[model samples]
Target: MGGKSSAPQVVLADDNSPTPSLPPSTSDDPTTSTASQQTTSTEPSAQLRPSDRTENLATDRTSNPSSSVQNENAAPVHTNQLQLPQGTQSSRRRRREASPANSREAQDRPSFDSLGPQGETTDEPLPKRRRRDHMMRLEGDNSNTNGGPRPFTNGSAADNLTSKSLNGLSKAVPAVNGSETINGHAKKTDAESSAYFGHDREEVSRLLIQALSDLGYSSSADALVQESGYDLESPTVAAFRNAVLQGEWADAELLLFGDRDGSEDEGTGKNNGQGLVLAEGAQKNDMRFWLRQQKFLELLEARDTGRALMVLRTELTPVYQNVHKLHFLSSLIMCPSTEELMIKAEWDGAHGQSRHILLSELSKCLSPSLMVPEHRLAVLLDQVKQSRIANCLYHNTEVSSSLYSDHRCDRENFPLEVAAELHQHTSEIWFIAFSHDGTRLVSCGAEGTALIWDMQTLQVIHTLSHTLPEHTQGVCFASWSPDDSMLITCSMDRYARLWDTETGQILRQLSRFEEPVSSCAWAPDGQSFVTGCLYKERNLCQWNLNGEMVYDWGRPHRIQAIALSNDGSLLVATDTENHLHVYNFTTRELEYEMDFKVRLTSVSFTKDSNYILISKIDGEIRLFSIENRKSIRTFAGQKPGKFVIRSVFGGADESFVISGSDDGYVFIWHKENGSIVEKLEGHRPGCCNSVSWNPKNPRMFATAGDDQRVRIWCNQTASAPVLHRRHRSTLSGPGPV
Candidate 1:
């Protein structure tokens, strides 16, 4: 090992004594004198790590062996040394009533903590629990046999220290005046090296190491940390991390709040930015309470009720913070066994470091410079890939991004070629959608019927049972429940009906809408459905599964199409006058509004529910960022003159925008740039009214049109493209087109 600070070391103590006594105070009682002198020191004492504390204890004892003995009549000295059992502790009384501050100090400060292995104070604090910071920081004595940096070896925790990053990379080569000589030639130092593209070599190396480790290339990460002499964290931080994950609670508390004073602990300080911040007095007490609570709960789970009780009165109750939590923890004391205690406290017992998801939450307050932020490099790389995809006009692949090259997807990756056509609808097909699970397709048309087709079999599974006459009351649109168990269908006949998706049995028919019920959408909870219509009264009416109206949001906007955000937070309704009304679903309040001059065809939210995509009769699709409340990007290049041509977000990450056109073609555009990528022609000349993209299968889509056909399209270049099938056309007389 390169640094003893990373490992717990227990020096063999003498038979009769422990550590030396502190310098004698003028007062007879050391506790009284120590309490009075608190905060008198101009600077905070440099708090010791667990290993440092152990070493100090040993050093004190070897310096003055006679100080180990205790005098029964003398004052109880300030000590973190080994303690006698509860039966053996002195019952000496205080000379005078202690002031609140002295009492608080006595309560908060660490006293007889048995932080070592084997429940012995002098045995070494959690022996052999090395720090992750040391291994990553490249500054500590590494224990790896290969002489390379490793991550959380033996399940040890990360050190939350900011290593001397500035000097780490330069260690690779000795440079004078920023240049080093190699083979009688001058070379730029690592900091000035062109290989890293002008970025700090140390930063690049550290991030690379982190990325490698997260990507499961621990061997490669270690090699880089060793070869570059750059580590991911500092020693003190590493020790603190090790202590917490190893259940050495007091040790972590010391590193975080210092010895009774909330001051920044000293260690590696070469980080360029301000590191972890010390919270104010109240916050410090709160944080201390948090750590103590975890320690207390774990003690109860360990069946160490004696220690757990001591923690409750001394460490926890004295802090005067989170009284409710303190009361709750106190209630757990009644549990008779470890299992009962765990159940009552709702504690995740120490399962290595995982039990205390405590470390991760605690680390958030720490500076990334001190502790390597979790998955730092992976997060950055993902952001980069997303940025490239957002800027790329033709990026359309599910293939993972490679660091070797900038990301770009071939145009053929997008599903463009028509795979199969269904001639089930006899009139103009208006609305088509895939179920939430993508296992079936639901289509409605002027034929006055809605058909549910199993995608796997490509056959109509449930021709919706409705009593309307053919071509008289066209089914406008349909929505599937979150579970795909039931569906709601809106028709031009001023009614919307709920039906069982499996058997096509009518569950209920809502007759509230005086005008045609144009569009319907299901709540994410599958408990309610929202209907939009041409509007005789109000345009938006929410109805529960019991067939009763839940809420009739006021306003008489003639809505043509509507969609609820998958998250159930937002409800977007598009009106005939080209207006967009966005409502807060839970609050039933209008959040905002946006308008376009041309009539709106349909409205939908992005998969993430952050953006609203509204297709218009002007042959353009506009993307409005919900937060920004305005159009961020508008996609054009489609013809939607006569009929409502619905466009939708599709492809990986919703990277592509697709719509069916009046000219019997399916137009696909790069959602980022509105650049037309493909205009797929197959349907007999007429409007391709609606399109639905498969959520599960990114390379598949279905489109319906006036040609009385529902066409299934898939990426022709992709392997196993839609299992091509031959079926009877059923186009006895070219019904719609």
Candidate 2:
């Protein structure tokens, strides 16, 4: 026993005591119950043994255990003594040593059995509050667990469990500030509001009264119900009921007067009581009859009338009148389509229902176009019913069905975006002309090809590709004679060829233009034509339809384009300079010459022959009155780059002017006002060369652009009608003609 007593005894002393289960700690320890609760989800406790706590307490001597321990018999310690001195290292060490044990005890011990029965052993489950706190602290300490020995977030079961629990808890909480529940405020929907305010007396009454104006009800209804100190409900409801139930006015006065508190004098002159009684009486008398009559008209409008008695029955009693009024109301209630009205009338005749009488009453106001003509009533009856009949009746001729049917013919409508688009083609489409009557449209591009299409159908009738022995190069300038009977085409081969429209056979070929003919124009009479060369000063060469070079407006200032007026007297030619020359074809002398500030590309007389529309190199259009030769309006809508005006033309009445620009927009404009009407934007990246209006329909026209696509526009309706692809022919291929 003495030898055993001499052996060393290890005493484990925890100077910084572990937390007690029965009560929460009030110490300044990091693992203090409150801090432990806050940090539990984000950080875990670093567990240390009691021996380590003692060693830490030894180093932190300032954390006096004697002062911290609260004995049951001892008095309270001062608050200053509880506070650690100015956060010293000893105080920190004492806190670290006891923190894990304090948190662990609080989390592990349960409320009921935390302090065991002997006040010695603790076997209780952790306190729910402490356990929750500890779990939170462990949330952020993902690295605390090492591999199997250390728990990986995804690899270990414990870590995965923690993640799942935390995720579930997060989902249970709502988003902080979302639209549906903005800052926790509940929202209301349109459906909910509608449910609370459905159609009722107030709503229905408003709707009925407003329908009067919308449905063409006469102002008499409003006038009779004027502020006569009478409630609108009794009169309105009474009026409707009388017209619906009783078909006569004998009771209308009585019903209207029954509710009156003021005008009750029985002996008062019958017509002296503000005339309302009489007016109401009058309305009551024929309203049902009129409503029934209205129904007949409605039948006429719908063109259907089901089998029913069309005659009015009168038995001099208030009840009969009300019934008649109800009959009238029924017509309105059963209103059908116009066709059905006629059917209803026919059916009524078959059913032995005074179809003749119904037609007679309705025919007084309705026209034969809508209602049968046999129903004409007597003059007196017609006069008596005029007001009521006029209010409800309409003739088929009076209303319109003027909207044309699609079968007639459909053309594309191109609403222009700018004033005009000019130079409609770059190097592709070379020849463009309107037929003599301006009906058939024709275009010939670089591939020796020519296409003729019906302007209305936009369907190509012929695509002529002629193989000629001598006329080999692809044609450039092609023009239709005034009669449209002959077409003359010229090319870079310095040769002009004329073709007979009926046979497609070459009439003749004149190889006289020293340079390539760049442009051609036929004289007003189909007898001769003129051609212009690009570089030669002697630009114009005249040849008869038989390919005879009969006349020459020799070397006209390096002419680029030429146009002849309807009269063979005037020919306007554009030279390389800013000047335009007008020549007297008969006199062979210049009539007038106008100088332009910018290079002029193309020019044409307005449809009325009142003004000249000129296209310039800068992509601008200027309107000049032929009489004054002075500019009237200038239209510019070219994109921000160097561009040329390819072509210019005017609608028949000079209402619209169209110009093609290098930027690929066909600008349509109001000729007089110079206001942009619409822009036909269709061509890809190329100059729009020429545009011509359909002489028959001003709304229809054709445009040729460098994109090798000739598009047609019948733009009378849409804002910007789509371009109908009329013809797409390649320019690089061998000449078709």
Candidate 3:
């Protein structure tokens, strides 16, 4: 971005400047007529004196009158009149404060001392209104500053002054607390109030600096850091970061970890006289792994498999012993092309990011010393957001948290009131579920009927009644296919029927079981489904969509409620004997099992498949982790002693446990603590059977009860809510088995 110059630096040298003369020549010819005629002021002392820092700018004398004259006008900016914003102490302010300066009237213009190449007076207009002025700015001459690639000429000072500015900042560490005052701000406390937990003044300043940079206030961050004398990183680390982003891994590694003796030695700090020693122990290995992982992935992207293999063996492999991860990394080489390898590896490669994401990951293991975590301020703000969400008991909506004030969701935002009611079922609704895409709702009625209602119209679009007269008394539980085009229903008449949801016609029927199929769960691919019977000797079986049994569990168990994780990894089933079995979906092997004191009535898997929600026959709901194989949190107080009251995980991030109760109220509890947030009392006086939260609509849900009514609910306080018709039925639930 800084490569091209719109105009040469010598163009501005003619403004109020004299002919070329060395500093000695200026003193010798004190009364030159041309020097006197060219300038308004008569101070050869201030005008011709070269900057102490810029003495290194040009070591050799040049005959070009343009550059030599520009060098004389490269006078030091009047630092005394240089007003910095509040809460900032210039890093060089103390050192230069004792240094004298000429009168403001004698000086031609404000100094570009903060930023600007030597001998160049930036014509940037003085800002009229600015809260805080940054001392330096990364100047790009055109509109294409953010676009296109600009080669870094590391050797040149005129090419992108950022590295040079940051170097000045890092070297000039302001004096500590005591009698030393910085700029006019107190050295004891940088930011005014007891913010940031009343941390070290420099720490808070650095955080603000980092936050400003993260917020795209690069100039402001630079100003605050240079003026406040607080640096976010050593210049070496900054260069290292730049190198990593630019795909210079060797330089970054050299800067960060550095080369040491074979044992890695005791003296590792500031190795090669650059960057801090980030960590010791496993953290160091993790840092190495992250750096090398990026390097390996990028190498693969470049199709440099040979170097990748070398890095894999000599670098990554020694850090991590995970064979599976190594195998996966190794398998990327087998990919036919670079694009294919990235797809399989799920990496965006160096081009897409090669950015701050790695910094974010690496920051998790890093202390806030050498490198501040990526988006540190955003992380802090999110912490505030989470606190606001957590304290707001009825937090329901996925609306983004506000930054100006303490985020608070009004209780009115919660979906507690019923929006609409449906009466298509002839008897009490045994089970109800929203389609995978949430365009339709399927409610199975005890009268051997299943109805599919359009979510848009809030009306019955298809009526799914049993084809055989003998199986007409059932239709208890229903599960939707992954595509939502078909569904399988568990019938009390000892049959499981798959139906075309759109046509409301039976697609396939499984009547091989001697007992009624009580529960069903579909695979993620919808190619097969697992069904369970409460009494059959070989109760659990997986059946293809064509009605053929593909595999059987072989072990007979009285399965009551069954569920498969959305990831299609685990199959969880609860039996009537108060036992729950978790099996690997690929292998019919039981992964984990839990014996409980009460019979589990229903089970629901979290979208992540890491945890499951189980409803009990004892009016209790418990959340269990599959890996732990035990209940982590138990939510009690719902009346389900006789009937199966299904509870499912819903709400934002599935953070709430929602269940239907015999008391006819829908109970919602916080998943983290099992504390009741709301007890929705809207259903007619009878036991509520099932609740189906609209997968597509977080604000709306449907509940089926013994009152034979399927009521749709939404965030009542919403403006107009979702406009839909209401219908109710008069009936009761089936008797206990």
Per-prediction TM-score to the true structure, in the order listed: 0.61, 0.39, 0.67
C-alpha local distance difference test of each model: 0.64, 0.46, 0.63
Residue lDDT tens for model 3, 503-592: 888889886678888999999998999999988575899999889989989777889989998888889888888989989888779987
**Candidate 1: Cα lDDT at 326:** 77
- Mind sharing the TM-score for model 2? 0.39
Give candidate 3's whole-model lDDT.
Answer: 0.63
Candidate 2, which segments miss by more than 4 Å at Cα? 1-427, 456-459, 464-474, 640-644, 715-737
lDDT of 1 by residue, 1-737 (tens): 34444433332111112333333211112133433321110111124454464455345434432445533223323322322110100011001111223323334433233233332344333224333232232222222222212112211111111111222332222222211221112232444344467455656777888889888999999888666655565445666777888888867875554333422332222111111233222255555677888888888888888999999999999875667877888889888887887678666588744434777767665655446667888788889987888777667667777889977776676676666777777788888999979999999888678999888767788898444544378887888888999989888888899999988899998875778888888888889989887974757888898889899887878888888998999998888877888899989899987778888888888878999888888787888888888788888777658677888898877888888877877888888777887878746587888898898888888888877788777776642434433233322222232
Where does model 3 exceed 4 Å of error?
Answer: 1-200, 246-250, 258-282, 293-360, 418-421, 437-439, 455-458, 535-538, 587-589, 627-630, 652-655, 680-685, 714-724, 727-737
User: Over the stretch 1-737, how does candidate 2's per-residue lDDT look in tens digits?
Assistant: 24353322211111112212211111223233432321110111112222342344345444443335543223322221231211110000000011122222323322222233332334433222222223222222222221111111110012110111111221112111111211011122343223225443322233344344345664743642231111122222234233324333333332222212223333231222111222212333332344445344433444454422232222223324466555643564355554454465344322244433543442333212112123122332345443322232111011222224211222233323221222222347755667858677777766666666655344555555543576646666677777777777767766667777766667787765677776788776677788888756447877776666687766547776787777666778888788888887788787888788667777776545566777787767788777787888887775533443455554544456776776677777655556666666656467776677666555556677676666655444522322222222222221111
The ten-residue window of minimal lDDT in model 2 covers 88-97
Which is the winner by TM-score between candidate 1 and candidate 2? 1
Cα RMSD (angstroms) for every candidate in the order listed = 16.5, 33.7, 16.1
